[model samples]
Target: MAASLAAPAPAKGAWLETWLAAAPAASGELALVQQRGREALRQQPIPSSRNEDWRFTDLALLQTLPLTAASPAPAALPEVASGALRLNWNGSSDPLVDQALPAGLQQLSADEIAQGLGHTLAAAGCEQHWPVELNHAAAEHVLALRVTSRSQVSLELVSAAGAGLQALRLLLLLEEKAELDLSQLIEAQGSGLHSLVIEAHLARGARLSHGLVALGQADAALLAHVAMEQEPESEAQLSSVMSGWGLARLEPRAVQVDGAAHTTLRGLQVVDGQRIADTHSFVEFKGPEGQLDQLHKAVAAGQGRSVFNGAVRVPRAAQRTNAAQLSRNLLLSDRARIDTKPELEIVADDVKCAHGATVSSLQTDELFYLQSRGIDADQAAALLQRAFCEEVLRELPAAARSWCSLERLLEAAV
Candidate 1:
């Protein structure tokens, strides 16, 4: 392990001060946000084991990433499907340059960007989270757009960073009755920090299907927060797959602003070597008759660690809310560790909410059965891991599923 990445926490402000000092001067339309983020981070120290929410995750891995910017050096990416628009983001340049967007999809004007930015994050109650502040402090540009009412659009975003720090911010609005299919991919080639924050709002009757695939190396780290707000009659489906990071933390938050919306969340993470992966998800029902279904899975091998915490809330005003959350984990090594927590808080007598979690190793009987069919022991174990991950992988959009191969995921897990 790299000593810089494994070093225990540093004195209160030493690490962050160095990183902030090296960041480019705050400028552009987001100058205010950047300034505020810096101020917030300066006042708060890196979260440690004492903080309940970050108790199991370590931020020490962030100390050594180069303060200088890295160039884009993504691996060979998969081809996009026919009729889908693909945009490559280099973290410093505008991705929409020289490309024509399809009808019904347009970039938001400066005024619109100012008004819509951070709206969903506030609605999801994570606007001031530590990771979010970090993104706000560093990100200089945002890709903001709107899908016209009743229009259907397909979009893909790809980013690959070499080394150092890369920050990306995105905002999406689905107007009433509109539909959008969005697939995003983030990959890292060397030691660095990848920071991402996404906020989306679904108006009444709007629909959004999103898939995210993140891959990293043993010395890289990733911090991401995806927040969404849905109006009545709207629907949102989000699926994510992650693997191979020194440390990765993902936060997905959703809010049914006025109830009567449908939200489906699925996540799968694979950790091997000495890497760590953690996911925290929250969903709240603000009005009656809301519906939610969430499932999260993880695979841990070697001395890697996996952690998951899922929370669902149904207030008194959210009567008739229906929600279910489940966490499933696979432990591939005795030294590996897995922690799963699924929580539900319901104050509405008429609401139905349930949550559960399970952690276990590969099924001995299943492995034996596969080996009896002439499959080698290693192949049998790989097959079981693949089968276990397919449930969530299959939920990804077609293009994302094609880009994120099943074999690649299994190879990373075991």
Candidate 2:
């Protein structure tokens, strides 16, 4: 039996107990938002080095530091602009940061809050290690968002430093036949971990176009979990470009629960400078007549490491489900490395699911050809690298363009 608490210990022993304990609890549907997370943490502790899922990553990096409680700082008008999305952080106090978002997207009901639960190892599978363990434990740094209408909301989410172990809960609900085009930016200061749990609820005939790009301090780690449920005739065209320093992980997970919902996922991962980056994506078809398409790209150079995992599962009830996943990797140097895994689990009798992976080095012939021309070997390699990434870059929407100035990003990365 679970031990009872006068209230409840702070979440996951995240080391943010005092900070979260000082925040106010939710009064709406997500009434016990903070309490439930704490309870869940109390029941199942986050995995450490013993867990396989996190074996490649370090969990103790979070427990070692004595981080001062995270507080929201005032943000001025963003210097950059893309797709009409302008971001301004007017938050002074951490408590008031919860209310700082545009009032157009606040829906903190109990059911909605409950839906945000279960991202933990205890919620998914006991054996796996969750990346957002500490963030979930803090629970106080959550932001719930609801997108209605054809929302052309351009967003730039900045993860400023000094705010260690924070969770940004984004709840987006697209109304019937509504549309949402969003762009996300994650930049952190100091060496701290930041996680964002994005819960998207798409109504019948709704559509969502989303993109995310992140960068952090060398010792920091970050994760983003996107959960989406698309109704009949709804569509989600999603793409991402992740370029960062340090140990970073990106996971895009979604389930189609009804009708003809479609999802398109395209991703790019670049690692160098002894940095390690991983991108994991999963799309599940739980309803009838839905389709999903996924493509991933990874490039590892120097002594850097990279990993890509793309999975698609179709349940028996999901008749006429069509799914496809592909992963491609490029190793620029002999020391550079990449681990690519593509998986498909389909129980549906009538469905189409396929997966493929490829790893190779830069073509010497191409290099020779470029050198044969006016281009030198180094320039040729950079050009080829640029071309190799062009496909993924072109797949991104306006949201991605703002987050990752790809051309500028690659100049330094390559």
**Top TM-score prediction, candidate number:** 1
| TM-score for predicted model 2 compared with the true structure | 0.80
Candidate 1 stretches greater than 4 Å from native: 1-10, 411-414
Q: lDDT (0-100) at residue 413 of candidate 2? A: 46
Provide TM-scores for the models: 0.96, 0.80
| Alpha-carbon shift of residue 227 in model 2 (angstroms) | 1.1
RMSD of each: 3.2, 7.1
Stretches off by above 4 angstroms in model 2 are 1-31, 48-52, 63-66, 70-85, 89-129, 149-153, 407-414
Q: In model 1, what are the clashing residue pairs, if there are any? A: none
Candidate 2 colliding pairs, count: 7
Candidate 1, run of 10 with poorest lDDT: 405-414
Please list the C-alpha lDDT of all candidates, in the order they appear. Answer: 0.90, 0.65
TM-score, predicted candidate 1 vs. hidden true structure: 0.96
- Native-structure RMSD, model 1: 3.2
- Candidate 2 on 1-414: residue-level lDDT in tens? 346636675455555454445545534333454465555555566655476444455444555443444444443223645444344321222333434544244446556646644433232232122444434444453444566665445455554545555556665667777767676666655566666666677788888888776655556666667667777888887777766556777778777776479888888878777777777777877788998888898888888788887777777889898888899899987898888888888888988778899999999899999999999887898888888888877766554564565464553343
